[model samples]
Target: MKFLIDNWYLVLTAVISGGLLLWTSLRGKSAGVTTTEAVRLLNREKGVLIDVSEPEEFAQGHAVGARNVPLKLLSTGEPVKQLPTNKALPLVLMCKTGARAGRAAGMLRQQGYTQVVAVAGGLAAWREASLPVEKSAA
Candidate 1:
């Protein structure tokens, strides 16, 4: 007891740091779609891939049939013109990294999209997995 009381500040800091680490790990596990799962969805289950990057980024290269919907529009809750009307379909969101996809997924869920998912590593991971990408028409 004497040692703990002598180093109270150190003990408190360690406790707080442990709690923060635990929270972050839990959060990551709860979100994100793996590349293998994404491929299965696209190939067998008819999943719709939505790229949330800017037009220029999307035009560079994207999942073969991905529809572009800028993160700006999604974050603001503006109606995306290109989204399919069928909300029952599984919609996969992607960005440069996985971060924006997660946010977009949340916004889409709030907008009444019941079946929404964010790609774990976004377009980069898809490419790394040797998936096909389609370039925009010049």
Candidate 2:
């Protein structure tokens, strides 16, 4: 205990760092939906896939039939007006990364969307899985 007492500051730092790492690992495991799982939900649950990409990026390429409601617009409450489905439909949000989609999903949930989900790996995972993408006609 002499060594720990002499290096109390170092010991405290190590304990705090270890606890933070443990908490982070546990927290990181529960976020987002995998591509296959998302597809299964889409097919079985009739989930509405909402692509939260900008207009230009969306037009370049996006999941076939995905409704493009840019994150900026969605955040501003404009996309809800344009959403084709009612609030009862299951909403799955997707973006280049899961970050924006997660935010969108949270917003949707706050807006009384009970079945809102965020696509785990986002569009990058869909492309990696060899899924079809639709490009807007130039």
Candidate 3:
């Protein structure tokens, strides 16, 4: 008790840090999969690579064969027209930095997508892996 009292700030910091980690885990956010796993899903499961970046961002550079489905359309809570009709099909999502893809993954999971996953590092990681990328006009 005396030690804790002397180091009250340390205890409080530890508590806050632990609480944040617990909250994040309890919220069911995915830690996301590596680029290698994403590729395996794409090749083995015939997963669709859905780039959640906006059209302009996607046009700048994106994974080869990735279909554009902006996060805005997904966040509306309505059925996304661009998604595959077969909900059971694997869906691999990515964005510029992966944050939007994570949010999009949660949204898709709520919509009954059984095999949805986000790339851990998004396009940057994909590029780092020397994966193919394509560019287009917006």
Candidate topping TM-score: 3
lDDT of 2 by residue, 1-100 (tens): 9999999999999999999999997766546778888888789988888899888888888898799888888777544665655788778788887788
lDDT of 3 by residue, 1-138 (tens): 999999999999999999999999865446688999999999999999999999999999999999999999998889877899899999999999899999999999999999999998899999999999999874
TM-score of each: 0.77, 0.76, 0.78
Go through the candidates in order and give each one's C-alpha lDDT.
Answer: 0.87, 0.83, 0.93
Count of backbone clashes, every candidate in sequence: 0, 1, 0
Q: Between 1 and 3, whose TM-score is larger? A: 3
Model 2 deviation from the true structure expressed as Cα RMSD, one decimal place = 3.5
| Candidate closer to the true structure by lDDT (higher is better), 1 or 3 | 3
Candidate 3 ranges with C-alpha deviation above 4 Å: 1-29
Model 2 CA lDDT for position 65: 77
Model 3's alpha-carbon lDDT is: 0.93
Candidate 3 residue pairs that clash: none
lDDT of 3 at 73: 95
**Clashing residue pairs, backbone N/CA/C < 3 A, model 1:** none
